[model samples]
Target: MPTIRLKTTINAPQERVFNLSRSLDLHIASAAKTKEKVISVKQTGLLELNEEVTWRAKHLGVYQNLTSKITQFNFPHSFTDEMQKGAFKSFSHQHLFEKISEEKTQLIDVFEYESPMGILGKLADKLFLKSYMKRFLLERNQVIKTTAESENYKKYIST
Candidate 1:
Protein backbone atom coordinates (compact mmCIF):
# COMPACT_ATOMS: atom_id res chain seq x y z
CA MET A 1 0.00 0.00 0.00
CA PRO A 2 1.08 3.58 -0.68
CA THR A 3 0.15 6.49 1.50
CA ILE A 4 0.18 10.15 0.53
CA ARG A 5 -0.16 12.91 3.04
CA LEU A 6 -0.58 16.63 2.33
CA LYS A 7 -1.18 19.71 4.39
CA THR A 8 -2.57 22.91 2.92
CA THR A 9 -2.96 26.15 4.81
CA ILE A 10 -5.96 28.21 3.78
CA ASN A 11 -7.21 31.66 4.76
CA ALA A 12 -10.62 30.45 5.74
CA PRO A 13 -12.51 29.06 8.66
CA GLN A 14 -12.19 25.37 9.48
CA GLU A 15 -15.92 24.87 9.20
CA ARG A 16 -16.00 26.43 5.77
CA VAL A 17 -13.08 24.39 4.56
CA PHE A 18 -14.51 21.20 5.97
CA ASN A 19 -17.88 21.74 4.32
CA LEU A 20 -16.32 22.66 1.01
CA SER A 21 -14.15 19.58 1.09
CA ARG A 22 -17.19 17.37 1.35
CA SER A 23 -19.46 19.33 -0.94
CA LEU A 24 -20.69 17.37 -3.95
CA ASP A 25 -20.76 20.46 -6.12
CA LEU A 26 -17.26 21.50 -5.08
CA HIS A 27 -15.94 18.03 -5.86
CA ILE A 28 -17.45 18.14 -9.31
CA ALA A 29 -15.85 21.51 -9.92
CA SER A 30 -12.45 20.38 -8.72
CA ALA A 31 -12.48 17.35 -11.00
CA ALA A 32 -13.76 19.14 -14.06
CA LYS A 33 -10.52 18.40 -15.88
CA THR A 34 -11.15 14.67 -15.53
CA LYS A 35 -14.80 15.05 -16.56
CA GLU A 36 -15.85 13.51 -13.26
CA LYS A 37 -19.52 13.33 -12.51
CA VAL A 38 -21.74 11.79 -9.95
CA ILE A 39 -23.49 8.64 -11.08
CA SER A 40 -25.43 8.28 -7.84
CA VAL A 41 -25.42 9.72 -4.35
CA LYS A 42 -27.12 9.00 -1.06
CA GLN A 43 -27.55 12.71 -0.56
CA THR A 44 -26.35 15.92 -2.13
CA GLY A 45 -24.46 18.85 -0.57
CA LEU A 46 -22.00 18.10 2.24
CA LEU A 47 -21.52 14.41 2.89
CA GLU A 48 -22.18 13.01 6.33
CA LEU A 49 -21.10 9.80 8.01
CA ASN A 50 -22.45 6.62 6.43
CA GLU A 51 -23.30 8.49 3.21
CA GLU A 52 -22.15 6.95 -0.03
CA VAL A 53 -21.46 8.44 -3.44
CA THR A 54 -20.63 6.93 -6.80
CA TRP A 55 -18.63 8.82 -9.36
CA ARG A 56 -17.70 8.24 -12.96
CA ALA A 57 -14.60 9.83 -14.35
CA LYS A 58 -11.87 9.59 -16.93
CA HIS A 59 -8.34 9.09 -15.64
CA LEU A 60 -5.18 8.31 -17.57
CA GLY A 61 -7.18 7.87 -20.76
CA VAL A 62 -9.50 5.36 -19.12
CA TYR A 63 -13.01 5.78 -17.82
CA GLN A 64 -13.72 4.40 -14.37
CA ASN A 65 -16.42 4.34 -11.74
CA LEU A 66 -15.70 4.47 -8.02
CA THR A 67 -17.96 4.30 -5.00
CA SER A 68 -16.89 5.44 -1.56
CA LYS A 69 -18.59 5.81 1.78
CA ILE A 70 -18.02 8.32 4.56
CA THR A 71 -17.22 5.90 7.35
CA GLN A 72 -16.27 8.44 10.00
CA PHE A 73 -17.06 12.10 10.47
CA ASN A 74 -16.48 14.81 13.04
CA PHE A 75 -18.03 18.16 12.30
CA PRO A 76 -15.48 20.79 11.20
CA HIS A 77 -12.69 18.56 12.37
CA SER A 78 -12.10 15.37 10.44
CA PHE A 79 -13.69 12.73 8.27
CA THR A 80 -12.73 9.45 6.68
CA ASP A 81 -14.02 8.01 3.46
CA GLU A 82 -13.31 4.42 2.50
CA MET A 83 -13.60 2.90 -0.90
CA GLN A 84 -16.44 0.45 -1.27
CA LYS A 85 -16.01 -0.30 -4.96
CA GLY A 86 -13.22 0.98 -7.10
CA ALA A 87 -10.21 0.06 -9.20
CA PHE A 88 -8.00 -0.07 -6.16
CA LYS A 89 -7.91 -3.17 -3.97
CA SER A 90 -8.75 -1.00 -0.95
CA PHE A 91 -8.36 2.66 0.03
CA SER A 92 -9.14 5.16 2.74
CA HIS A 93 -8.94 8.94 2.54
CA GLN A 94 -8.91 10.97 5.70
CA HIS A 95 -9.61 14.69 5.68
CA LEU A 96 -8.54 16.66 8.73
CA PHE A 97 -9.13 20.32 9.47
CA GLU A 98 -7.30 22.32 12.13
CA LYS A 99 -8.08 25.83 13.19
CA ILE A 100 -5.03 28.01 12.93
CA SER A 101 -7.04 31.09 13.82
CA GLU A 102 -10.60 32.33 13.53
CA GLU A 103 -9.86 33.14 9.89
CA LYS A 104 -7.26 30.53 9.07
CA THR A 105 -7.35 26.77 8.80
CA GLN A 106 -5.06 23.89 7.98
CA LEU A 107 -6.45 21.18 5.75
CA ILE A 108 -4.73 17.83 5.79
CA ASP A 109 -5.29 14.85 3.56
CA VAL A 110 -4.08 11.34 4.30
CA PHE A 111 -4.68 8.89 1.48
CA GLU A 112 -3.74 5.23 1.78
CA TYR A 113 -4.47 2.75 -0.97
CA GLU A 114 -3.56 -0.73 -2.10
CA SER A 115 -3.48 -1.43 -5.78
CA PRO A 116 -4.91 -4.57 -7.40
CA MET A 117 -3.04 -7.25 -9.34
CA GLY A 118 -0.50 -7.95 -6.58
CA ILE A 119 3.06 -7.62 -7.88
CA LEU A 120 1.90 -5.95 -11.05
CA GLY A 121 0.21 -3.30 -8.93
CA LYS A 122 3.37 -2.77 -6.94
CA LEU A 123 5.26 -2.22 -10.18
CA ALA A 124 2.65 0.26 -11.37
CA ASP A 125 2.91 2.21 -8.13
CA LYS A 126 6.66 2.53 -8.56
CA LEU A 127 6.40 3.45 -12.24
CA PHE A 128 3.75 6.20 -12.33
CA LEU A 129 0.65 5.53 -10.24
CA LYS A 130 1.95 7.12 -7.03
CA SER A 131 3.04 10.33 -8.68
CA TYR A 132 -0.14 10.50 -10.72
CA MET A 133 -2.27 10.09 -7.62
CA LYS A 134 -0.28 12.73 -5.76
CA ARG A 135 -0.72 15.22 -8.56
CA PHE A 136 -4.43 14.44 -8.67
CA LEU A 137 -4.74 15.11 -4.95
CA LEU A 138 -2.73 18.33 -5.11
CA GLU A 139 -5.02 19.67 -7.82
CA ARG A 140 -8.08 18.80 -5.78
CA ASN A 141 -6.63 20.57 -2.73
CA GLN A 142 -5.87 23.64 -4.81
CA VAL A 143 -9.49 23.86 -5.79
CA ILE A 144 -10.61 23.59 -2.20
CA LYS A 145 -8.11 26.24 -1.14
CA THR A 146 -9.14 28.61 -3.88
CA THR A 147 -12.79 28.17 -3.12
CA ALA A 148 -12.44 28.50 0.63
CA GLU A 149 -10.34 31.62 0.39
CA SER A 150 -12.86 33.38 -1.79
CA GLU A 151 -16.56 34.08 -1.72
CA ASN A 152 -17.08 31.30 -4.30
CA TYR A 153 -17.43 28.87 -1.41
CA LYS A 154 -20.84 30.34 -0.63
CA LYS A 155 -22.12 28.63 -3.75
CA TYR A 156 -21.32 25.26 -2.22
CA ILE A 157 -22.00 25.69 1.49
CA SER A 158 -24.37 27.79 3.54
CA THR A 159 -22.65 30.32 5.77
Candidate 2:
Protein backbone atom coordinates (compact mmCIF):
# COMPACT_ATOMS: atom_id res chain seq x y z
CA MET A 1 0.00 0.00 0.00
CA PRO A 2 1.12 3.57 -0.69
CA THR A 3 0.52 6.50 1.65
CA ILE A 4 0.46 10.13 0.67
CA ARG A 5 0.78 12.88 3.24
CA LEU A 6 -0.05 16.53 2.68
CA LYS A 7 0.18 19.54 4.91
CA THR A 8 -1.02 23.12 4.81
CA THR A 9 -1.22 26.04 7.17
CA ILE A 10 -4.45 27.92 7.76
CA ASN A 11 -4.83 31.27 9.49
CA ALA A 12 -7.31 30.56 12.24
CA PRO A 13 -7.40 30.00 15.95
CA GLN A 14 -6.68 26.55 17.31
CA GLU A 15 -10.09 26.05 18.85
CA ARG A 16 -11.96 27.60 15.96
CA VAL A 17 -9.94 25.84 13.29
CA PHE A 18 -10.11 22.51 15.06
CA ASN A 19 -13.84 22.73 15.47
CA LEU A 20 -14.38 23.55 11.85
CA SER A 21 -11.86 21.01 10.64
CA ARG A 22 -13.57 18.23 12.49
CA SER A 23 -17.09 19.11 11.49
CA LEU A 24 -18.77 16.57 9.23
CA ASP A 25 -21.32 19.04 7.96
CA LEU A 26 -18.67 21.62 7.15
CA HIS A 27 -16.65 19.02 5.27
CA ILE A 28 -19.59 18.17 3.06
CA ALA A 29 -20.33 21.81 2.42
CA SER A 30 -16.76 22.46 1.30
CA ALA A 31 -17.05 19.84 -1.42
CA ALA A 32 -19.29 21.37 -4.05
CA LYS A 33 -18.81 18.47 -6.41
CA THR A 34 -19.83 15.83 -3.90
CA LYS A 35 -22.75 15.18 -1.56
CA GLU A 36 -22.81 13.27 1.72
CA LYS A 37 -25.17 11.65 4.21
CA VAL A 38 -24.71 11.03 7.89
CA ILE A 39 -26.17 7.71 8.87
CA SER A 40 -25.53 8.18 12.55
CA VAL A 41 -23.65 10.25 15.12
CA LYS A 42 -23.29 9.58 18.80
CA GLN A 43 -25.13 12.43 20.49
CA THR A 44 -22.79 12.25 23.43
CA GLY A 45 -18.99 12.09 23.48
CA LEU A 46 -18.70 13.91 20.18
CA LEU A 47 -15.13 14.92 19.32
CA GLU A 48 -14.10 12.45 21.94
CA LEU A 49 -12.09 9.32 21.50
CA ASN A 50 -13.99 6.27 20.25
CA GLU A 51 -16.81 8.26 18.70
CA GLU A 52 -18.24 6.63 15.60
CA VAL A 53 -20.01 8.07 12.56
CA THR A 54 -21.61 6.43 9.56
CA TRP A 55 -21.74 8.37 6.33
CA ARG A 56 -21.85 8.10 2.56
CA ALA A 57 -20.67 10.44 -0.16
CA LYS A 58 -19.99 10.71 -3.85
CA HIS A 59 -16.46 10.95 -5.25
CA LEU A 60 -15.40 10.75 -8.87
CA GLY A 61 -19.12 10.45 -9.56
CA VAL A 62 -19.40 7.25 -7.56
CA TYR A 63 -21.26 6.73 -4.31
CA GLN A 64 -19.43 5.06 -1.45
CA ASN A 65 -21.03 4.39 1.89
CA LEU A 66 -18.83 3.89 4.93
CA THR A 67 -18.90 3.43 8.67
CA SER A 68 -15.91 5.03 10.33
CA LYS A 69 -14.98 4.95 13.97
CA ILE A 70 -12.77 7.52 15.58
CA THR A 71 -9.69 5.62 16.60
CA GLN A 72 -7.98 8.46 18.32
CA PHE A 73 -8.82 11.96 19.50
CA ASN A 74 -7.30 14.54 21.80
CA PHE A 75 -9.74 17.41 22.11
CA PRO A 76 -8.37 19.05 18.93
CA HIS A 77 -4.77 18.25 18.35
CA SER A 78 -5.11 15.11 16.24
CA PHE A 79 -7.53 12.37 15.27
CA THR A 80 -7.93 9.38 13.00
CA ASP A 81 -10.83 7.64 11.29
CA GLU A 82 -10.68 4.06 10.07
CA MET A 83 -13.21 2.90 7.56
CA GLN A 84 -15.25 -0.15 8.40
CA LYS A 85 -16.67 -0.58 4.93
CA GLY A 86 -16.26 1.28 1.68
CA ALA A 87 -15.42 0.87 -2.00
CA PHE A 88 -11.70 0.65 -1.40
CA LYS A 89 -9.90 -2.44 -0.19
CA SER A 90 -9.00 -0.29 2.83
CA PHE A 91 -9.25 3.35 3.79
CA SER A 92 -8.17 5.65 6.59
CA HIS A 93 -7.70 9.39 6.99
CA GLN A 94 -5.78 10.97 9.83
CA HIS A 95 -5.97 14.69 10.54
CA LEU A 96 -3.46 16.53 12.65
CA PHE A 97 -3.59 20.12 13.86
CA GLU A 98 -0.89 22.04 15.63
CA LYS A 99 -1.00 25.57 16.93
CA ILE A 100 1.79 27.52 15.28
CA SER A 101 0.72 30.95 16.49
CA GLU A 102 -2.19 32.65 18.17
CA GLU A 103 -3.99 32.80 14.84
CA LYS A 104 -2.50 29.98 12.81
CA THR A 105 -2.64 26.21 12.76
CA GLN A 106 -0.71 23.61 10.83
CA LEU A 107 -3.04 21.10 9.26
CA ILE A 108 -1.80 17.72 8.14
CA ASP A 109 -3.85 15.10 6.35
CA VAL A 110 -2.63 11.54 5.87
CA PHE A 111 -4.53 9.01 3.84
CA GLU A 112 -4.23 5.33 2.96
CA TYR A 113 -6.42 3.63 0.40
CA GLU A 114 -6.11 0.45 -1.59
CA SER A 115 -7.54 -0.23 -4.98
CA PRO A 116 -9.42 -3.42 -5.80
CA MET A 117 -8.93 -5.89 -8.61
CA GLY A 118 -5.26 -6.68 -7.98
CA ILE A 119 -3.61 -6.30 -11.37
CA LEU A 120 -6.03 -3.68 -12.58
CA GLY A 121 -5.57 -1.89 -9.29
CA LYS A 122 -1.81 -1.91 -9.66
CA LEU A 123 -2.12 -0.58 -13.16
CA ALA A 124 -4.54 2.16 -12.15
CA ASP A 125 -2.48 3.22 -9.17
CA LYS A 126 0.66 3.52 -11.22
CA LEU A 127 -0.83 4.82 -14.43
CA PHE A 128 -3.43 7.34 -13.31
CA LEU A 129 -4.86 7.06 -9.80
CA LYS A 130 -1.73 8.36 -8.09
CA SER A 131 -1.46 11.94 -9.30
CA TYR A 132 -5.18 12.34 -9.88
CA MET A 133 -6.04 11.15 -6.39
CA LYS A 134 -3.50 13.46 -4.83
CA ARG A 135 -4.96 16.44 -6.65
CA PHE A 136 -8.46 15.46 -5.57
CA LEU A 137 -7.56 15.39 -1.91
CA LEU A 138 -5.49 18.57 -2.07
CA GLU A 139 -8.28 20.46 -3.83
CA ARG A 140 -10.71 19.34 -1.16
CA ASN A 141 -8.33 20.54 1.53
CA GLN A 142 -7.86 23.85 -0.22
CA VAL A 143 -11.60 24.33 -0.22
CA ILE A 144 -11.68 23.56 3.48
CA LYS A 145 -8.85 25.96 4.14
CA THR A 146 -10.53 28.72 2.16
CA THR A 147 -13.89 28.24 3.81
CA ALA A 148 -12.48 27.97 7.28
CA GLU A 149 -10.63 31.24 6.92
CA SER A 150 -13.69 33.15 5.76
CA GLU A 151 -15.40 35.70 8.03
CA ASN A 152 -18.78 34.02 7.74
CA TYR A 153 -17.35 30.69 8.79
CA LYS A 154 -15.74 32.31 11.80
CA LYS A 155 -19.01 33.90 12.87
CA TYR A 156 -20.94 30.69 12.39
CA ILE A 157 -18.47 28.64 14.36
CA SER A 158 -18.30 31.23 17.09
CA THR A 159 -22.01 31.22 17.67
Candidate 3:
Protein backbone atom coordinates (compact mmCIF):
# COMPACT_ATOMS: atom_id res chain seq x y z
CA MET A 1 0.00 0.00 0.00
CA PRO A 2 1.13 3.55 -0.73
CA THR A 3 0.58 5.82 2.22
CA ILE A 4 0.04 9.56 2.05
CA ARG A 5 0.25 11.56 5.22
CA LEU A 6 -0.55 15.28 5.53
CA LYS A 7 -0.21 17.07 8.80
CA THR A 8 -1.53 20.59 9.35
CA THR A 9 -1.72 22.82 12.38
CA ILE A 10 -5.11 24.46 12.65
CA ASN A 11 -5.88 27.47 14.82
CA ALA A 12 -8.55 25.70 16.85
CA PRO A 13 -9.00 23.44 19.83
CA GLN A 14 -9.01 19.68 19.57
CA GLU A 15 -12.70 19.30 20.38
CA ARG A 16 -13.92 21.97 17.99
CA VAL A 17 -11.60 20.75 15.26
CA PHE A 18 -12.68 17.19 15.83
CA ASN A 19 -16.32 18.16 15.55
CA LEU A 20 -15.61 19.96 12.31
CA SER A 21 -13.87 16.89 10.96
CA ARG A 22 -16.90 14.76 11.75
CA SER A 23 -19.18 17.19 9.95
CA LEU A 24 -19.31 15.85 6.42
CA ASP A 25 -21.20 18.98 5.43
CA LEU A 26 -18.34 21.23 6.45
CA HIS A 27 -15.95 19.07 4.49
CA ILE A 28 -17.98 19.32 1.29
CA ALA A 29 -18.53 23.04 1.68
CA SER A 30 -14.85 23.72 2.14
CA ALA A 31 -13.79 21.89 -1.00
CA ALA A 32 -15.67 24.03 -3.48
CA LYS A 33 -14.97 21.94 -6.57
CA THR A 34 -15.48 18.48 -5.14
CA LYS A 35 -18.79 19.73 -3.70
CA GLU A 36 -20.11 19.88 -7.23
CA LYS A 37 -19.05 16.36 -8.07
CA VAL A 38 -20.69 14.76 -5.07
CA ILE A 39 -24.39 14.13 -5.58
CA SER A 40 -25.26 13.38 -1.98
CA VAL A 41 -23.96 11.84 1.23
CA LYS A 42 -25.87 11.02 4.34
CA GLN A 43 -25.33 9.13 7.53
CA THR A 44 -28.41 7.01 8.01
CA GLY A 45 -27.17 5.14 11.07
CA LEU A 46 -25.49 6.09 14.28
CA LEU A 47 -22.31 7.97 13.52
CA GLU A 48 -20.31 5.99 15.98
CA LEU A 49 -18.50 2.71 15.39
CA ASN A 50 -19.55 0.78 12.27
CA GLU A 51 -21.89 3.55 11.06
CA GLU A 52 -22.25 3.63 7.28
CA VAL A 53 -22.39 6.56 4.89
CA THR A 54 -23.36 6.30 1.26
CA TRP A 55 -21.25 8.56 -0.97
CA ARG A 56 -22.14 9.30 -4.54
CA ALA A 57 -19.72 11.29 -6.67
CA LYS A 58 -18.50 11.72 -10.21
CA HIS A 59 -14.78 11.26 -10.52
CA LEU A 60 -12.31 10.08 -13.12
CA GLY A 61 -14.90 11.12 -15.68
CA VAL A 62 -17.43 8.64 -14.35
CA TYR A 63 -20.08 8.33 -11.68
CA GLN A 64 -18.36 6.65 -8.76
CA ASN A 65 -20.26 5.36 -5.80
CA LEU A 66 -18.63 4.30 -2.58
CA THR A 67 -19.89 3.23 0.80
CA SER A 68 -17.73 3.83 3.83
CA LYS A 69 -18.32 2.74 7.36
CA ILE A 70 -16.74 4.13 10.45
CA THR A 71 -14.13 1.70 11.63
CA GLN A 72 -13.11 3.78 14.60
CA PHE A 73 -14.29 6.95 16.28
CA ASN A 74 -12.72 8.44 19.35
CA PHE A 75 -14.61 11.66 20.01
CA PRO A 76 -12.59 14.91 19.89
CA HIS A 77 -9.57 12.88 18.90
CA SER A 78 -9.60 10.55 15.91
CA PHE A 79 -11.52 8.35 13.49
CA THR A 80 -10.97 5.95 10.61
CA ASP A 81 -12.97 4.91 7.55
CA GLU A 82 -12.65 1.99 5.18
CA MET A 83 -13.96 2.07 1.65
CA GLN A 84 -16.54 -0.51 0.61
CA LYS A 85 -16.21 -0.02 -3.13
CA GLY A 86 -15.22 2.29 -6.03
CA ALA A 87 -11.57 2.18 -7.15
CA PHE A 88 -8.49 1.03 -5.34
CA LYS A 89 -7.71 -2.36 -3.86
CA SER A 90 -7.77 -1.02 -0.33
CA PHE A 91 -8.49 2.48 1.02
CA SER A 92 -8.36 3.50 4.60
CA HIS A 93 -8.20 7.08 5.89
CA GLN A 94 -7.29 8.02 9.44
CA HIS A 95 -7.98 11.45 10.87
CA LEU A 96 -6.09 12.54 13.96
CA PHE A 97 -6.56 15.60 16.14
CA GLU A 98 -4.17 16.77 18.83
CA LYS A 99 -4.40 19.70 21.20
CA ILE A 100 -1.06 21.40 20.87
CA SER A 101 -2.02 24.22 23.20
CA GLU A 102 -5.03 25.69 24.95
CA GLU A 103 -6.34 26.86 21.60
CA LYS A 104 -4.26 25.32 18.84
CA THR A 105 -4.79 21.89 17.40
CA GLN A 106 -2.96 19.74 14.94
CA LEU A 107 -4.94 17.90 12.28
CA ILE A 108 -3.38 14.97 10.51
CA ASP A 109 -4.74 13.05 7.58
CA VAL A 110 -3.19 9.69 6.94
CA PHE A 111 -4.35 7.84 3.86
CA GLU A 112 -3.32 4.35 2.82
CA TYR A 113 -4.32 2.83 -0.48
CA GLU A 114 -3.17 0.03 -2.75
CA SER A 115 -3.60 -0.13 -6.49
CA PRO A 116 -4.83 -3.32 -8.16
CA MET A 117 -2.17 -4.37 -10.65
CA GLY A 118 1.26 -5.42 -9.54
CA ILE A 119 4.04 -3.70 -11.47
CA LEU A 120 1.76 -1.47 -13.45
CA GLY A 121 0.25 -0.22 -10.26
CA LYS A 122 3.50 1.30 -9.15
CA LEU A 123 3.84 3.11 -12.44
CA ALA A 124 0.32 4.45 -12.23
CA ASP A 125 0.85 5.55 -8.67
CA LYS A 126 4.03 7.45 -9.43
CA LEU A 127 2.65 8.91 -12.61
CA PHE A 128 -0.80 9.88 -11.40
CA LEU A 129 -2.55 9.11 -8.13
CA LYS A 130 0.29 9.78 -5.70
CA SER A 131 0.84 13.41 -6.58
CA TYR A 132 -2.82 13.95 -7.24
CA MET A 133 -3.74 12.53 -3.89
CA LYS A 134 -1.20 14.73 -2.17
CA ARG A 135 -2.65 17.83 -3.80
CA PHE A 136 -6.15 16.70 -2.97
CA LEU A 137 -5.28 16.28 0.69
CA LEU A 138 -3.59 19.65 0.79
CA GLU A 139 -6.54 21.40 -0.81
CA ARG A 140 -9.00 19.76 1.53
CA ASN A 141 -6.85 20.74 4.46
CA GLN A 142 -6.90 24.33 3.28
CA VAL A 143 -10.68 24.23 3.16
CA ILE A 144 -10.78 22.80 6.66
CA LYS A 145 -8.42 25.44 7.93
CA THR A 146 -10.50 28.22 6.43
CA THR A 147 -13.76 26.85 7.75
CA ALA A 148 -12.34 26.30 11.19
CA GLU A 149 -11.14 29.89 11.29
CA SER A 150 -14.42 31.32 10.11
CA GLU A 151 -16.49 33.31 12.60
CA ASN A 152 -19.41 30.88 12.60
CA TYR A 153 -17.26 27.95 13.60
CA LYS A 154 -14.79 30.05 15.52
CA LYS A 155 -17.41 31.37 17.94
CA TYR A 156 -17.81 28.56 20.46
CA ILE A 157 -14.59 26.80 19.55
CA SER A 158 -11.37 27.92 21.08
CA THR A 159 -8.64 28.63 18.53
Local accuracy of candidate 1 as per-residue lDDT tens digits, 1-159: 799999999999999999999999999999999999999844368888998999999998999999999999999899999999999999999999999999999999999999999999999999999999999999999999999999999899998
What is the alpha-carbon lDDT of model 3 when measured against the actual structure? 0.74
Scored by Cα lDDT, where does model 2 land? 0.74
Evaluated with lDDT, which candidate comes out highest? 1
The weakest ten consecutive residues by lDDT in model 1 span 39-48
Write one digit per residue (lDDT tens) for candidate 2, span 55-114: 677866788777777787876688888877776687788888989998898888898888
Model 3 off-target regions past 4 Å? 35-47, 154-159
lDDT of each: 0.94, 0.74, 0.74
Clashes of each: 0, 0, 0
Best by TM-score: 1
Q: After superposition, how far is residue 11 of candidate 2 from its true place, in Å?
A: 0.7
Off by over 4 Å in 1: none
Sort the predicted structures by TM-score, highest score first. 1, 3, 2
**Tens digits of lDDT, candidate 3, 68-130:** 778999987899988877677889999999889977899999999988788898898999978
Order of all candidates by lDDT, from best down to worst?
Answer: 1, 3, 2
